[model samples]
Target: MNILRDVSKLVCKTDRRALASLLKYAETGLKPQYVCKGHMSLASQTDQNEDLDKLYRMVEVEVRGNDPAVLKSYSWFTTTAAMELGITVGECWTPRKANHERLTLLKSVHIYKKHRVQYEIRTYFRFMQFLRLTGSTANTFLEYIQRNLPEGVAMKVTKVEITAIPSHIKTHSEPQQLELPATVEERNL
Candidate 1:
């Protein structure tokens, strides 16, 4: 029994280390064996770099996949686009089921204007890119759609879920209302 316990502990330790190494790769795109600089074959280093590149894309997809806000944006945009084309849309996963899933993706996007096709949009984060394309904060996602969408298209969002998504796109609009109203004492000053 003591021997069994020792062996079990060893197995558990090895498993933990393995998990740690994978997580380290996921976070920093580093491979465990290649961490220390030493004599390694050029082929091996190339293989490790390729593996790291795949891991980084997977990590990015995983992060964006599990984000509810990102999923919501995806759903909103896909649903809106589908509605415009008279295509039916349904939830890919329930809120409960999504907790265990690695990715939440829209299965279909049927566009009937300027292009007519029914197919899968490659990534779940496509709408996140669309929001960025519109030069809109996530807070103003609906507003951006409202302004940029074709003449008859529209989208609506609830009062909540207005948290910002970081964007670097520049728009031509001028700044508005940065100055604060003067207080009585401040006015005297």
Candidate 2:
């Protein structure tokens, strides 16, 4: 997902004014602080200018939820998985019948017509890696998600199904085996 590059863009490219202020402070050896000027804080100023409240809402943080870190980590996992799958990361995704929040741990990947089961399996394992990286237990993550689900919400299965193609010849077609000649010159034909 190139986390470093994306984060760098957010920090360096997007926040140019903040960068300039910091640079000015560094050059002058004076703490350059933006006057409140009715803006709560410099950070808030930048956020307000960019409509961060709306952007943060897109992140879908549940105010009632205790650990905001879970939501943040879930967002990271979704982005990483989407990048690995070569799909554009959206504000949300539908893993199955469940919503984005329900599928945060990605207990199962939904199968579709013409979809590659192998790729889905790889993505699932890689998401497990992300879960571990985010200080979550890989084995218990699904159980935890299940426990946290709201009342009356049924958990949907995410297993990918694969079917094997038969190698047998068709019964209606007569099997014609090719015969090779013993001589090299004859084999060429």
Candidate 3:
């Protein structure tokens, strides 16, 4: 029973170390070749690097409106469109006043209510799919937004920006072997 308990404790410690190493890799983007007793083989590393090289594009649309309700409706419309197009829609940022100046009492209150909202639509694709996303595609997306805008609201698209995120390719090399110190019991033995 004592031997079994010691073995279980050792296993748990190893598991914890392995999980921590994986999490470190995720957070810092550092590729760890040795995990516990297992080795991240060269072929696996190459495959992972290849997958990371894939590109993703993000489309940011800026919309301005005077009514919060209209902006909410537009947000829903854009989310539905992104789903239909098989893309991901990021959360809309809180609407901010387009003009920051304090309004005088004589000025129209309507001018002070102007707000702007930004939406991000992201799509991940391979080389061929990326090629399919061209200027016409953006135009089509703009036309869709323009056509679906809620009525009775003075909403207008301020700007549309598209940017691509390309992964940094790293050269693959052999990982140095780390020497671990012996456990207390092993050292005593």
Clashes of 1: 0
Q: Largest TM-score belongs to which candidate? A: 3
Give the per-residue Cα lDDT of candidate 1 at 140.
Answer: 44
How far residue 160's Cα lies from its native spot in candidate 2, in Å, is 5.8
lDDT of 2 by residue, 41-109 (tens): 334434455421111111121211223345445546545653564433334432322222322233346
Q: In candidate 2, which residue pairs clash?
A: none
**TM-score list, all predictions:** 0.19, 0.19, 0.34
Model 3 segments beyond 4 Å from truth?
Answer: 1-56, 95-100, 105-133, 151-189
Q: 143-178 in candidate 1: lDDT tens per residue?
A: 434454433222333222222345656564776767
Q: Rate the local accuracy (lDDT) of all candidates.
A: 0.38, 0.37, 0.50
- Ten-residue stretch with the least lDDT total in model 1: 53-62
Best by lDDT: 3
Candidate 3 per-residue lDDT, tens place, 30-131, comes to: 655555565343235445645322223545565555555666667777767766875556546643334343332424546663553444332211110111
Worst lDDT run of 10 residues, candidate 3, spans 123-132
